[model samples]
Target: MSFDKFKPKYKIHSETENYFKLRAEAGAKPYDQLTVEEAREGNIANAKRFAGTTEFEGTVKEFTVPSKQCSDGIPITVYRSKQCDLCVAPSVFVYFHGGGNVVGCRQTVDTICRIFSRDAPCVVVNVEYRLAPEHKWPANHEDAICVVRWVKMNKGLLGAVNRSTVGVGGDGEGSRMAALVCHEVPDLGYQVTCIFHASAA
Candidate 1:
């Protein structure tokens, strides 16, 4: 059916309906009003609540890059495909999490990163950039730029094909950050596709 901007139609699935119902019963605050701590907690809690007991296949090598080593010295977790190694590596995707850049961290998007690494059969760099209400504006953007540059700068170690194979992306706010980085950096490899959606109801 063709969509009508003024008269859009959709249904809230029962499962989704129940989730919100449960949240209401538990006194979950509206998103706009949530305290920073509450917002952070909700991101983690929702991830666990939805993913209970489910495990996806992948391999991970994690490490912290001191500020001296990479952008802002962020904590980065590298997820790899089962078949991936320095010999098999050709590209790296740097990802950022949503949460308005206020709530999410590396862990919040762990599952997707693992899946991306495995399915793409490439290295996934999950970056934990400084958040707002703390780091301030341009800080996140700077971190994004620096991290992508770091990947390009360390392509030999990351097993990337070359500086041109270093890509960057994120969900929600992160996607916009990716675009900003692409705009500012001029030459960040391929940018991963980022899709977003919202409901007016």
Candidate 2:
């Protein structure tokens, strides 16, 4: 049976209803029916499409930088608001995209990073970590730690508002990584001022 028949009875906001309509039209396959690679590609495509519709008042810069914790260099996209040009150092928010540890990349959260950068008036670093089932548990977590550490160590280079005002955050599986980073890296000199998690509803 088609899942649309099970739509919620309660009235949802128009925007939400439109979002569901878009998803339904996208014809996403059941996760169980797809291979890891297929799921990843599909999620990326969806994210890119969603991102294309968003308009944020910020500048984005892409980089492929080395990570001490992971052999494969990390890919990061930095988002900064125009106001940031006036400030000597903008605060930083390191973001991880949601994918249940199996699907997603930096592009998956491109729009989110832009929103955060504009609204928070801080630099948003969207991290692209290796996925799971292929690169198992703790791998993503380790990558989170590495990215946070790398940001902390290189805050000046990142144009951070202040080296001391760093934060970690994510959605879904990415949230788990953010929480882990906050919990595991307490000893780091710079404090993670915020830990934002957009858990699934």
Which prediction has the highest lDDT against the true structure? 2
* Model 1 spans with C-alpha error above 4 angstroms: 1-8, 11-22, 51-58, 66-72, 85-88, 159-164, 193-201
Q: TM-score for model 1?
A: 0.78
Alpha-carbon RMSD to native, per candidate = 4.8, 4.2
Please, what is the TM-score per model? 0.78, 0.80
Q: What is the per-residue lDDT of model 2 for residues 85-176, given as tens digits with 9 covering 90 to 100?
A: 76666778888888788777887777767777776678888998877888888878878888887887777777663444788887877777
Please, what are the lDDT tens digits per residue for candidate 1 over residues 162-197? 533678888888888888888877666677656642
Instruction: Provide the overall lDDT of each model, using Cα atoms, as 2-decimal numbers.
Output: 0.71, 0.72
**Judged by TM-score, which candidate is best?**
2
